[model samples]
Target: MLKDEVLKILLSSGSHVSGQDISNKLGVSRTAVWKAVTALKNDGYDIESVNNKGYLLTKNKSILNEAEIETCMHLYDCKVFPKILYFNSIDSTNTYAKKAADLIPSDFLVVADTQTLGRGRLGRSWSSPSSTGIYMSLCIRPNISLEKASMITLITAMAICDAIEELYNISPLIKWPNDIVINSKKICGILTEMSCDMDGIKYIISGVGINVYDTEFPDDIKDTASSLLLETGTKTDRAKIISSAIYHFYEDLDTFMQTEDMSILKSKYESRLANIGREVMILDPKGEYPATALGIDETGALIVNANGKIKRIISGEVSVRGIYGYT
Candidate 1:
């Protein structure tokens, strides 16, 4: 924890931070500060310590950790996520979040560098190689009904798009209900799970898996899936993206919770929707149908024109896809 505190000071200082200043601020000994810096360096952080100058955290393509993420949260002045729980590797952030749901507070984040058992929507495996992706889950307890909970996934997709657009300067698109894509290739997936009883809603675990640095994919998904590096030809800081996503979620969540519907947020979401104005095939359990995506309505349903007839497809009810291939 002292290392994290030292990291925050170094990051925000933007220059060398004196050991004495860190000790005074954190109410610890200078020896403790020196030890913290050493720990950070051991953890793969690029830190510089000169004879006169204190410590400087030079930017590098290091792995995701709690200190960097918390520093980003502080730099961005984000409020919703007060606590961040990070893991080097895990079975799945979603599974961990759910298991520890009652223990953790609302807006607590669970992030991992790699997932041994990563998952996606419709029972698909998400590729989660080491140092190649961001796997995180946000835990929240909103006082809304179960019916309105599905919209959280859409809101998360929009938040991720906000992060990508701002950080990478790339215009990301939402593939219908729960996917983020660039150049028509998916770079992220979202799975939102809710728990509740007759009383009210308990909590929602919004799991997001983002392909950050991967340049290649499996043979089966090479044609459809992509990463930020593949899309932008540049390496990205995973912590900043995570911080931005959390910030944007709180930004849009206020407007959404006010109405408990997508009416207020539908316009913004539709503008970045990849399925809008496109012909997509809906894979329903009953059967498949071809339709032109009109956009989402106030209730977060996909509005489509099916053979001159209008129909609204609910989230989790069906999978929408481009007629030619995955979007």
Candidate 2:
């Protein structure tokens, strides 16, 4: 707790803070302050000490830490700041969020620096290197029906796009249901999973992964996958992005829950859809269909012109060459 208080002081100060000031503020001794500083340093904060300047947080490479994230949440004025469970490395944020769903509050979040077995839609692997991306899952227990759960994925995508645009002034596009793209390259992904019964929905976990500072990718995905750093030529503030996204997501979710209608977000979501007006290959269980995307309907379903007939694609694996070159 003392370390968190010291961290708050250092983060707010934005300059060197003397040990005596920190100790006096917390009513603790200078030795205790030193111990807290040492613990913070051991926890991966790049704190600098000088003979006269005292301690300065030179760098915060660990952006996903609980204290930093909570500070960011407070800064953004989130209505209800969720309890965050942070991990240095994990298999999957979604997996953990699901397991902890019943125990934690509906607004709880599970975040990780890296996920060794990160996942995407359709059981695909997501690359999650340490300290380079945001891998987080938000658990919400909305009193909505199972049929409306898919719309949450679209809501999350819109929130991510809005966050990136507001933070960096770069407009990112949503690829159909859950992917975010920039310049036809994948920058973010969202995977929504749920647990439910006849008595309405129980809990839904929205997993979001954003490639922030990473500049390298596997040979197979190098051309299609990209990072905010690579696209914008600068490192972004991860904590700010996270806080902004959660803030916007809750704001949009409140509107959605009241009406249970994707139409509330249809216009904004349609404006940022990348697949609209593009030729795409839809992989459905029955068969594959090549179609030109028109746009999303009020229910968040993909409306496309399949051959000469107009069909609404409720759910499928949509492969657009303009998105990731999946043929």
Candidate 3:
């Protein structure tokens, strides 16, 4: 924990921070600060210690820790997620978060290094390799009705797209409901699950899986999957992405909850909609049909021109590759 605190100080500082300053801030001795710095260096942070200048984080190479995430949150002045639960390995962050939603405080985050049983939308498997991607779930209890819950998914897509563009200057598009893509390849997938009663939602667990540094995907998903490094040719700080996403989500959450509709975010979300004006195949249970995507409605449903009729689809299997060559 001392190392995390020291790391927060080093990460937030633009220049070197004096050891005495750190000692005074954290109420620890210089020896303890030195030990914390040593531990951080051992954990793969590039920390430089100058005799007169004190310490600085010279470089960050895909480094992710609680302190770094907290530092990013502090930089954004966001306090939506009051507590963070981190794990080295787990079955699934969403699963863990759902089980602990009622037990822990509201609006807590669950992050994992790797997931043995990661899930995607429609019950598909999400690839979560160790130390190569971000597998996280944010558990929140919103008092919105079931009809308005889909807005959370759309808001999440916008949050991630904003975060990626702000951090890496790469434009990411939303593949309709719950996928974030860069250059037509999926860089992130979101799965939002909720527990509810007849009254309203008790908790919503939003699981996000991001490809950060993986050079290769599984043979099955290689064609449709991509990583941040592969897309931008640079390694990214996963914690910053996480913090930025949460920051943006909380930024728009108030208006969304107030109006309980997409009036505030409709245009912004449609600007990044990958399916606009594109021909897509809607996989209906009775039969498949071709349609042209017009955009999304105020309720976050995809509006499409099904031949001569206008249809607003809430959620189903829809393929956007008729325009983008992606699944």
**Number of the top lDDT candidate:** 1
lDDT of 3 by residue, 104-221 (tens): 8668889999999999877888889999999999888888887788789888889889988998998899888888888889999999999888898888888899998999999999
Q: Could you tell me which 10 consecutive residues in candidate 1 have the lowest summed lDDT?
A: 74-83
* lDDT for each residue of candidate 2 in 5-52, tens digit (9 for 90 to 100): 898888877889999999999999999999999999988888998887
Cα deviation of 10, candidate 3, in Å: 1.5
RMSD of 3: 1.8
Runs of candidate 2 exceeding 4 Å displacement: 15-21, 24-27, 43-55, 316-327
TM-score of each predicted structure versus truth: 0.97, 0.91, 0.94
Residue 110 CA displacement from its true place in model 2, Å: 0.8
C-alpha positional error of residue 235 in candidate 1 after TM-score superposition, expressed in Å? 1.7
- What's model 1's TM-score? 0.97
Model 1 C-alpha lDDT per residue in residues 141-218, reported as the tens digit of each score: 989988888899999999999999999998999988988889888899999987898776799999999999998899
lDDT of 3: 0.87
Best by TM-score: 1
Ranking by lDDT: 1, 3, 2
TM-score result, candidate 3: 0.94
lDDT, candidate 1, residue 275? Answer: 88
